[model samples]
Target: MPTGVLYVMSTVVPGLVKIGKTTTGRFDDRMRILERNGYNNVTGLHREFAIEVERYDEKERMLDDIFSKARVPGSELFALDINLAIELLASFEGRQIYPKTSTESKSKVFDDAAKNHQENTDIQCIPEGTYYLDRKRPPLHVEMVVEDGALTIRAGQRVAEHDSDRADDRARELRRATVAADGTVRANVHFSAPSQAAAFIFHLSSSAPNLMALQKVVA
Candidate 1:
């Protein structure tokens, strides 16, 4: 049987490192997904090394030795730049190299009053009208367009005239979204009380560029 060490770690562009491990090889998929989603230039390496111990404790000791003898990020032992082999080994530590399955990586956001929507009242609902939106991905702020019956989402200079179903899905997640008959989008979007709603709003604001413009409309 063939056996080898599996590592799961992440590196900072320019320079930084996060190390990890796993028993399986799924880490590769995770790294790919991250790259496709936005994180690029990541690399994974695997290699075989000799073991001097047969017992479990002995093997543990050997791993510890390798760690101690290497210049891993947080390791206090060994000279900072002297361990080439250890640096290579440190690459796989604590990082997942693979992307998770769709089911596993799907967006976890949804309607849940249980999550504290006090601040939900703060999400300003743009009036029913017309506006532009910049399309990209989740966490990217959208442009606001107030109109009647339906709302238009835009990406870049182009409006996302299509994907109404998906757009509606996005709208519904907003507790303060409403659409009116006169083509007016309205919402109070209160941002106070429990920390979760505030956190969620902050997250959306920071991650999504122009989300305040993508205010959900309601009727």
Candidate 2:
């Protein structure tokens, strides 16, 4: 069974919530992605809570059924208001969050990231595409193509993430990306949100999902 993280979120609006899942290490990345797109007319999304489950897909469906009365017109989003929505989640929670494996000190995390970067300087996962993000002057972005669940994050693009555990965890995956004439990053990562993809390329924090705005150049 694929063990992963299940996230339940709500927006500032009264009656809407989101339930989604992702890999354990990629939860923050996933949330940043959803929080970016979770709101309809609100500032952003607020996570109600999240937990790691052995059968995440099954749990999601189970929650969907339990809250069938609050089912909304769209996907995964429920119509239950925030207060009751969160309460229902707590009541119907099937499993608890995954336990931490090891908690590294902030300094150690940075040190380990630097070492991993130096050690993984040769691997590159490059693809072909003229992808662009932002229409501003000197828009910060990458041009890459996807193949076999892997892709290359181009050079010339830089992303600065926070000095928190979230960034430290993401850095491990970021280090393996090899920079080439075209790619400064190459790795076996997949992002559901375009924003998430952009953040991954830029090495930003899990909030990358909220910050990226990449678009295809359409050559």
Give the least accurate 10-residue stretch of model 1, judged by summed lDDT. Answer: 105-114
Q: How close is candidate 2 to the true structure, as a TM-score?
A: 0.38
| lDDT per residue as tens, model 1, 1-219 | 223333223333322222333224444464455434522234332211211111324323333443343333353222221112222232222221222323221111112211222223312222334332222453233334433433333222221222233233333344224333322334433222212222223233221212321213223
User: In model 1, which runs have C-alpha deviations exceeding 4 angstroms?
Assistant: 1-4, 8-10, 13-15, 33-219
lDDT for 171 (candidate 2):
49
Using alpha carbons, what is the TM-score of model 1? 0.19
Model number with the top TM-score: 2
Q: 134-213, model 2: which lDDT tens digit per residue? A: 42333454555544444444444543332334443554355444333343433344443333454455544533222322
Q: Estimate each model's TM-score.
A: 0.19, 0.38
Note each model's CA RMSD in angstroms: 19.1, 16.6
State each model's CA lDDT, in order. 0.28, 0.47
